[model samples]
Target: MKRELKVTSDGSKTLYMENWDECYHSVHGALNESMHVFIKNGLNEVEADSLHILEFGFGTGLNALLTLSERGGRSIQYTALEKYPLSEEEWNAVAYGRTSEERVAFASIHLADWNAPVEIESGFVLKKVETGFEEVEFEPNSVDLIYYDAFAPSAQPELWTTELFTKCFQTLKPGGFLVTYCAKGQVKRNMKEVGFEVMALPGPPMKREMTKATKPSNV
Candidate 1:
């Protein structure tokens, strides 16, 4: 799988996989999509003193970097899953971290050890899990939020199956929510089949819709 660096619409870089015709983030704007989909729509929806988040497809650690940067006085325990971790060459090619502080944060995120939790900074603990989403096991009712940032269903249909979303339902606490850039009808149906209250939200640039699935509080 050969990956090349592509400058997105927002001047940020994303990995373009020639083999799968897939990209690590949206081509419209890599940073734009991440902030809109994962931060605004996902993290902002939850209001708590502390949060436990499970993210699928860690990719270049962009989402984690953004979340850590937005501390807002709340503590976050982040567990990210990455089946195919990015190599140093791929990540280094990204043109992020304009400021010296941001550059340091980016370096700290990528340098963290895998399969073990490390406090990248005060109030931000990150655990990088080197495993596939389906193969990973999570403690039931433990996660408060799920960033389902896996590749599109077209690229990896197995990750979008009803069974996997069922596992997501079980892993999340009551009233927890899962967010993703995908809003395909079948994907929404699969989430519904597993007792998730699904909603279609506005997508990022060059896209139409995104999905936000929630576990009911009473269930």
Candidate 2:
């Protein structure tokens, strides 16, 4: 593996080896993008007291930490997939500057064994899967929410292809939502081709748009 781990321009987040460039949280603002996609669009619609969440790229564990901190009384079964996982030192360096509560939660996730189910808190269960995006497997129609945080299409084109969206389509239950910071025309079109109802929405600062795609009930 290449030594690609380094602090980003934001100085608070670390960039990992997956050719992904960004912090776990926005150095500009931590809660901004996360709230828009994950909380508002992803978790808010789930009716079940417990929900199954799948994150395509568990970079920085920022989204997971934030979700656990804000959502109370609901059980969350989170399965995160990553090809090149971050090391403990890398996670700790970036996580320590977060809220004390979030810092604690983030530590728990980083320490848990990969590919094995681990309980992060009373209502949250986390499982980290270390595998290539193409090889990571999940049951069809099983995931309630998906955090599509892969690198930009320019950097990692394979992750943004139609075949990848097709896999995501198969993994979602009816009404499940897949949220991402990307709203490129090709990305949206590819998602639509895979049977998802794609929505273009306002993105974080410096970005013009984002995307949220839902699996149809009929599919």
The number of the candidate with the highest TM-score is: 1
Give me the candidate number with maximum lDDT: 1
What digit string (tens of lDDT, one per residue) describes model 2 on residues 1-219?
443445443445545444355334444444567667777777776777888999988877878887787677899999999887877767766654356777777888888999999999998999999987889767998998899988778778899999999999999999888999888899999999989999998887666788999999877
Which consecutive 10 residues in model 1 have the weakest lDDT in total?
89-98
Which stretches in model 1 have alpha-carbon errors above 4 Å? none
Error of 2 at 181 (Å): 0.4
lDDT of each: 0.91, 0.79
lDDT (10s digit) by residue, model 1, range 1-219: 688899999999999878778999998999999999999998888999899999988998999988887758799999999978888777878946857887798889898999999999998999999998889878999999999998888988999999899999999999999999999999999999989999999999999999999999998
Question: CA lDDT of 33 in candidate 1?
Answer: 97
Cα RMSD of predicted structure 2: 2.6
lDDT of candidate 1 vs native?
0.91
